[model samples]
Target chain A: MSITVAVDAMGGDVGLDVTIPASIRFLQDHPEHRLILVGDLPAIEARLSALSADARARIELVHATQVVGMDEPPQLALKNKKDSSMRVAINQVKEGRAQACVSAGNTGALMATARFVLKTLPGIDRPAIAKLMPTVKGTSCVLDLGANVDCTPEQLLQFGIMGAELVGSLTRRERPTVGLLNIGSEDIKGNETVKQAGELLRGSALNFYGNIEGDDIYRGTVDVVVCDGFTGNVALKTSEGLAHMVSVFLREEFTRTWWTRLCALAALPVLRHFKARVDTRRYNGASLLGLRGIVVKSHGGTDALGFRFALEQACEEVGSNVIGHIADQVALQLEKIQRPAVEPSTTPETL
Target chain B: MSITVAVDAMGGDVGLDVTIPASIRFLQDHPEHRLILVGDLPAIEARLSALSADARARIELVHATQVVGMDEPPQLALKNKKDSSMRVAINQVKEGRAQACVSAGNTGALMATARFVLKTLPGIDRPAIAKLMPTVKGTSCVLDLGANVDCTPEQLLQFGIMGAELVGSLTRRERPTVGLLNIGSEDIKGNETVKQAGELLRGSALNFYGNIEGDDIYRGTVDVVVCDGFTGNVALKTSEGLAHMVSVFLREEFTRTWWTRLCALAALPVLRHFKARVDTRRYNGASLLGLRGIVVKSHGGTDALGFRFALEQACEEVGSNVIGHIADQVALQLEKIQRPAVEPSTTPETL
Candidate 1:
């Protein structure tokens, strides 16, 4: 049977300008794949009608009456707006009508709706949002972005397992090494939570590489890095800020003189390629793991190209069967968690 | 009256190469200042003897045979390394022989020694390590860098007061805004610890700006950002890693062509200025707040220039009476901590 992906048409700052065209482009390229546009019907159709004949023929629309505002609370909106773009998109996946769902809407709303529709896997406490942030090694995924803030040692151990599975499956790595983000690289550097978690990770079934420091997070040192939503969220935003600052500093330095600007013109091609290497857009969406169906939350400020990338990532996750692997890993880890063994605590920093 | 600044000549990777020379430089620049170099007297004196005529006349050496290893546990070293560079440095400050102590040794050892010799402020539970990191809006100070992990709400409130006092005294801002870093910008998005910290922050008398996201930290949005040492440590390290990545990316991007190299050459002056602005050397030291006498820990890899900058920073803190201000702020905040106070139960992610 042919597979279908649901696109949240009304989401993101630059709505259908890129979304509609990108979806059509994807369908034209893949004959077996289909699209279910979940947003305003007339608005999408009105935009599509203006496109070429081939673009019009490849599109289908499924109306989602309400749109989740960027500022609205995710759980509140999902509870109140049953037919919001976020909900409709995930519902399409939950109902088995679509293989995966992609949304550039509120992360909270997307995560909340995903939990309700896809439901958590067996033995999973809470779902976490995992984003593949650009790092020195390649790309490293940091989980619990905002799903659950106060993660327990058990949750962190689970995150390690799940993160390892995702990283190993997505990247061409086998049994990737996992590191617990801590203040220092020593085994005895972190707080009580990390200390206890470190013990658990040491004894767990995964390829735990002991503790890593915050500086080690984006160093591409580990295959999987796990932490609470608060720490993970902080790391993601700090990286973005640094990246932004770097770009600002480079541009400022580049335009310092007339000669420098001329050099900028000559080396624009290489600079463009470098920018692509560190481009956050190419990283695309954060997968909401521990859920039955694939749900990727695209960056809120995503462009058409980013949305297309998000779609590609969602399809990859479904095709890779990472969820099944995570389930297997979790099932394996479950046996160890139940054992009456105690491990000493250590974090990334003091390892 | 002569002001004394004790220097740990046997600390850090470069040890005397950076610390002794930097101490001599500081003394030469500030003729009124008294120098008491703490370490192996012969080794420090040898380095001092190599300095120019003017610096030698202004500098003196105090012998301390022990030097704490970077990998040693702080507690064990505190117990055994009684005559270590860190202990001797802080001891001089405590004995009224020096007004402040500066070390580029093991941070934990320095912090431990400062506490052992100088003691904590009255009614203070623990001392915090506060750092001044480069940000878009010039720079900002974050406290409890690696001092106390898994900090309680009460501890976070204390961190806010001490950090605010330090920032205000150093940055000279009337009331530096304090932000409780968390996953979201809302009043209630984080776990129990952060949620409770928010309540304590709001109840306390410091100038709190509610909750701030990770992205806003580097934007210079808040002057004193408060969190548990675990989270603070992660944020600091992550920011450092990102900054390093940015520089590396630029270096690689600039090497793309000969024209880019020419551009880099022409932009060298401006780039140097930019580099100096964000360089770790300018803000190499982290102040150990709550100690009776001023103490600063320079990075282990710090060079002579970094050591010089750290010595200058210690002088500024001493001259400004940063700890005295923190003591005064603590007295004010202590009264607020006693009341049933607003419940600190709401996490940051919920807000």
Candidate 2:
């Protein structure tokens, strides 16, 4: 079946200028897949009118009455902006009008909207935002990138399982190795919650790689690293901060003197190549995993190329059946591991 | 008032190979300061015998029968190895034999030993590891790096207070700005713990810069970034990892072809200049603030030069009286803010 992605056209900093162009660009490459643009009708139509007639044929529009402000409270956005572009796009996935949804909007509102519209999968207490971060080797997927800040031990275990399944599907690794993010690699490290979660993951059927420190995220030590939203979000943002700082430092150093400027000229190609490898825009899309439907959150400040990457990520998830694959794995693992007296608090009925 | 720093001679990866030379080098530069080397008698003496006559005059060796293994449990190391270099060095600080202590040993053991021996100052429930991290502007001091993984809102506020004082002393800024690290900068962002800490900081005497996200650490948005130990440690390590990854990628790219290798050679001076700007070794020492005595934890794997920088940090802390400064500030802030019924649960007895 042809994949249909719901594009939240009114979301992000540049809104339709980026979304419409990105949808058009993505359609050119992905001829089989169609896009349903969900946003303010007049604005979207204005952008759409500029597109060629053939490009418009592969697109559909679902008008959204409201737009969630970037800084609006997630709860207020959820309650009041029922007809927001972000919510409407997610609704397309819930109602089977689209195979997946992509939005470059307020992260909190996007997560809240997706969770509310699509709901969680069976046996899942909470959904996590799984982010792909660049590493030395390739990239590693990290989960709970600010979904639920205070997660129980069981929820962390679920994140490990879901993250493992998602990475496994994307990378085509039979079982992606999962690492629990902590302050130290030792089992005795971290707080009570992390230690308990380690025990649960170790007993499960996952390819558990034990505890990993913060550096391991970029070291590419494991396929997936799992943590509560608070830790994961901080780690992710700190990396971004460091990367930006390094770039700024490099620019300042390369322009310090005439000799350094000449050196910069000689190293321009290598620097450009290095920039491509560590560019944050290349890793823009973050999958809001664990929901019944696929919803990818793009960086609000990203360009059309970055938005297209988010669309590509959504298409890949749809093709790989990530949601179904994770559900089956979660069910199978829970059944085998939950048999012992030390079962998780989540009841079988939840599964 | 000669500043005497107790050195854990038998700590870290290479032990005396780094410590002895670092101590000698540090003493050569700071003519007024002294170092009391604490470790196995014979081993320390053998290394010390190689030092110059002038260096030897300012150095004293204290015999410690045991050494704390890098991987030993903190509690186990504390109980069994009372005479360990790590423990003995801390004891020197506690007994006023030294003004400060520096160790490149087990972080947990160092924190545990220092807390048990030196104890926390009044109004300081727990000691925190305040780390100096490189930023675009210069460097920002972040705490608690790993001392208390699970910190309460009150403890976080105390971290902000202590961190502010420590930075104030080191940077010589009368009122160093403090930023509470969180997922977002908005008042509504972060979990309950972070939110409460914001409230406490806002109502206190600190130069609160408000909430800052991860990138703000590298952006040098504030002088002191305060968070729970878990978040601080994770953010710190993640930046290290990314820096390492980028360097690896740069090396790989620069050596990819003959032309690129030539480019690397041309850019060698610029690259070296950039490295010096962001060198981790320059920011080696981590101050274990909140304790009655001063303790600095050096990275376990650092070499002589890095160890020397850690010694410099210890000397600076001693000269600035970080501990006394923090104690006075904490007391003042507590007295001013504790009048409200919303006083923290930490009683005067605990303080």
Candidate 3:
């Protein structure tokens, strides 16, 4: 099955320098995929002039007169930059011209523009930013990274459902286990919203793993970790800060003297292997789940290689039909809740 | 002046094994300090039989008949375990027999009992847990780790003041910069409570650095980083998880094969130095701030070295008169807010 993805070519810190190259590389690697590059025509063409005919045949260009600034406010971007590259890219997804959209623009602006254009899935009050994080056993999907600072218990339940569906589709897992993020693992922990969310999750159709602490994210104790955006964002950013600091500390120790530098040279291969095991670029894309169409947000500061990983992520979501799965799951859950007289033996099996 | 700290000898995972030796080491190191060991007489005597005469002279044994289980609920521990080592240790502070208390018991029980015994300072609503985290520049003090799940705007302002006072007294920095932790550094970021807290911090006499993201905690952008307990707890635990994962990855890479093992041996010294730089044991103690008396909670799973560090922390707090400083700071801020006619030039100087 062929998938088409719209790229915000004029977005991110380096604009065309990263996006254009990333798009060309993705097209070359994915023969069954096509891309619509949305940006300034002259600028995009300048970078793509060296592409082969086969790659050019798989690519389309859409002109956008404006570009959203990396630090622009979300509300202003949504209201004023209607013709921006980010907006045009999302429009392709809304109009069915592309199955998914990929952007490395300002996160707030991307979320606002995409939500404005594509709307949200039915029964989902708000869209959440879900991202894959590296864990000891494997990767865990955590949601609401920074989309909504304050989340209702119902919204958290929706996030759990959407997260389970996303994981199920991507990994072909029949029933992914979901865990509510809390300060403690016990039932009587966290704020009122989280406690209420835990009860809702326990009674839902999804496989609810009890409450999990922050350390459980790296432990890979559950497939899906759900929390309010404020907590999730803080956890994610704190991890990044810690990882950076450790690397800096390692560098300082490795170069303290000539003998230590020599030892570092001898251990270079092992260090490189360790770095590859926890590379952030491999997990560059964050999906805006619960949206009507698939939209993946790349890290704004990433290079072409990292942006290519994001494009690949978009293609994977499109091919797996994640949106349909989420919609079906939501409807099924609602039906189960509404039908009060249904017996346990007569209930339908979960997906 | 000699400062005496009450030690809960039957707390933590290792119980008497860790606390007794740690207390003996602490007493040997600080001749001007003393310890009141509270636990079962037989168990406490068994460990202290090997201590020197000089060390024994500075130590006092106060037998407590009961013990608080590590997993016991806070309310139950507070009500049922009246003569528990944890409770008895806290009572020493209440009865003015000890200047401060150190415990490695259940955090909830420690907080509940400490608050019940010491009560809160005049202008403080609740006690917050503040601990020092290593950062790129030096170290940043953050609070409240998990005391209150839901905090009001006024409570957050109180936390900022408490955090500023803690850092100021500990580092002797007269005026420490305080940063409100949020998802973004912009004034428009975070939830309503955080936004209001930011406004309050800015208007106060603190060296208010408007707002900081999670990364700022590690970057040491400010001396004191303040947040609601839920967010702070998640951030702290997430850092622990990430650091653990990285170390595990490094070990796997180093022991992958004989060649890698050889490289690891060659780089052992540099690796040890790196490990010591980011040692969690060195930063073991967490201060329960805003209470009328001093209390430090150690990690439940720590060894003798870590518990000794907690003892050192309690002694430092007692010597610095942290409670008095916090009370003074809170009162001064309250007075400034109440007297609306005080001009900026006529305002009293902050501690």
Candidate 4:
């Protein structure tokens, strides 16, 4: 079966400049996959005309009259912009016209629209935005990037279970190691919510590695790190800022004098390799986990290469049936634990 | 008047090897400061014997019969180890024997012991651990590293006030810009605590800059970034881990080939400059803000250079009367806010 993905061509800062070319490249690379570009018809069509005939044949365009502004509030977008490219792309998955949806739109808008359109997987109270990040060992997935800012202990446990399922499916491992992102590794560390979540995780069936600190996220101490959306988002942005600052500083040093510039030329390949290892673009796509249907969010500021990676992520998730895996695992875990009382509460005030 | 600082000479991973030399160096540089080294008498004296007669005159040794282990639980250290160097150092501040206290012992133990001995300043509910971090624009101070893991909105407001006072005192700025760390700059972002804190900060007398995300910490967007202990600790450690990994990666790249090795030699000066700019040692000492008296926590794994920086931080805080400034500001802010009904509730469950 061919996996069809809806691309929000008018989304993100670059709009069709990046999304259109990315969709074309994705179609060229994966012949078995199909793409439906949702955006302004004339603009997208113009970009599509630049693609090869074979690539063009692999794609379909759905005209979207409205474009959700990057800074618009999620509530405003959700209530008014029904025909927005971001919403329309997600609606494709809702209507089963596409297997997955990819957007580089406002994260808040993307999350709100996708959740409203697709609802949430059974046994999953709220959908979480999970992203892959480069680590010392390899890549690790951190969830609840900005989905649910406040999470209960039960909700956190659900996140852990869903994270384990996602990692297990992606890595083809029976039990992927899961760590509760906390202040310290000690049992007595973290706030009450985290401590209670730690207890729940320890007693659960997951391959729990006790508690891991924020440093553990990059150390690759675990395959999945679970935290409240607020913490996860803060950690993610802080890492991005630090990574960017380091690059800027390194570049400043490397171009200080003629001799240093010569040294930079001599060490170009090593620098390039290092850059590739820590490239933010490589980790652009974020999985909107726990959704009934697959949706991947690309960074709004990403270029075409990054958009292509997001499209690839959508395709991979569709092929892997990650949504189904999480739904089934969560249901099974919920049944086994006999914690029918412990439903994943979606209330932020309860936190 | 000569400032006196009590040093936990037996604390940290390296013990006397780092502390003894660091104390001597600090005293030699600052002729007006006196240090009372609290630890095992013989162990500290043996290392102090290596210092010149001029350096030794500015130092006094106080025997501490017990030593707190690095991994020991804070509650255990507090309840059982009264004579531990960490406790004795804090006690000196309580007894007016020293203007400040410095320790590189178990962080939890230090906080617990300090809270017990020095207590919190008037109008301050909890003492936060604030540390300076390198940024694109000089450095910024982030607070509540791991003190109050779960905090109320009002407590967070108090933290912002205290942080501003600390930054104002250190930077000699009349009013330092303060930022409340959140997932987004929008008013709707973050958990209830953060959102409410944002409102409280905006309404207060502080130079509030609204919400700042994790990236803002390194962007030098504000002078002080206030957060709950749990989030602040995670962000702090994550930055540390990322910085360390960047250096490790850079070293690996610089040593990859013989040509790269030659480039490394040529770029030695630039590398040294970069290292100095982002050196962890330069930012080692963390201020235990909100306390009645000043206390600085050194990194447990610091070497002599790092320890000396920590000592300098203590001297700076003592000279500036940072604790007094914070206490006065908090009291004034509390009066201005007219929130006498809102006392800082120290319960994590309330979060």
- Regions more than 4 Å wrong, model 4: A339-351, B339-351
What would you estimate as the lDDT of candidate 2? 0.90
lDDT score, candidate 2, position B150? 87
lDDT string for model 4 (A1-351, tens) is 699999999999989899988888888889888999998998888777667777788788898999999999999999999999999999999999999999999999999999899998877788888987778887788987878888988789899988887777666667889999998888888878889999888988889998998898888899999999999999999998898888888898889889778867777787898898788888889998888999999999999999998888887788788888888888988777656455665568657
Q: Each model's TM-score?
A: 0.93, 0.96, 0.96, 0.95
lDDT of 1 at B333: 77
- Over 4 Å off, model 3: A338-351, B340-351
The Cα local distance difference test for each model comes to 0.82, 0.90, 0.92, 0.88
lDDT over C-alpha atoms for residue A274 of model 2: 92
Pairs with steric clashes in candidate 3: none
lDDT measured at residue A331 in model 4 versus the true structure, 0 to 100: 91
Error of 2 at A258 (Å): 2.0
Q: Which lDDT tens digits does candidate 3 get at residues B147-196?
A: 99999887888888988878876778778899999999899999999998
DockQ of each: 0.53, 0.85, 0.80, 0.68
**lDDT by residue (tens digit), candidate 2, A35-108:** 99998898888877767677789899999999999988999999999999999999999999999999999989
TM-score of 3: 0.96
Q: Candidate 3 chain B: minimum summed lDDT over ten consecutive residues — where? A: B342-351
| Model 1 spans with C-alpha error above 4 angstroms | A50-58, A257-260, A339-351, B52-54, B257-260, B337-351
Span of 10 residues, lowest total lDDT, candidate 2 chain A: A341-350
DockQ of 4: 0.68
Rank ordering of all candidates by DockQ, starting from the highest: 2, 3, 4, 1
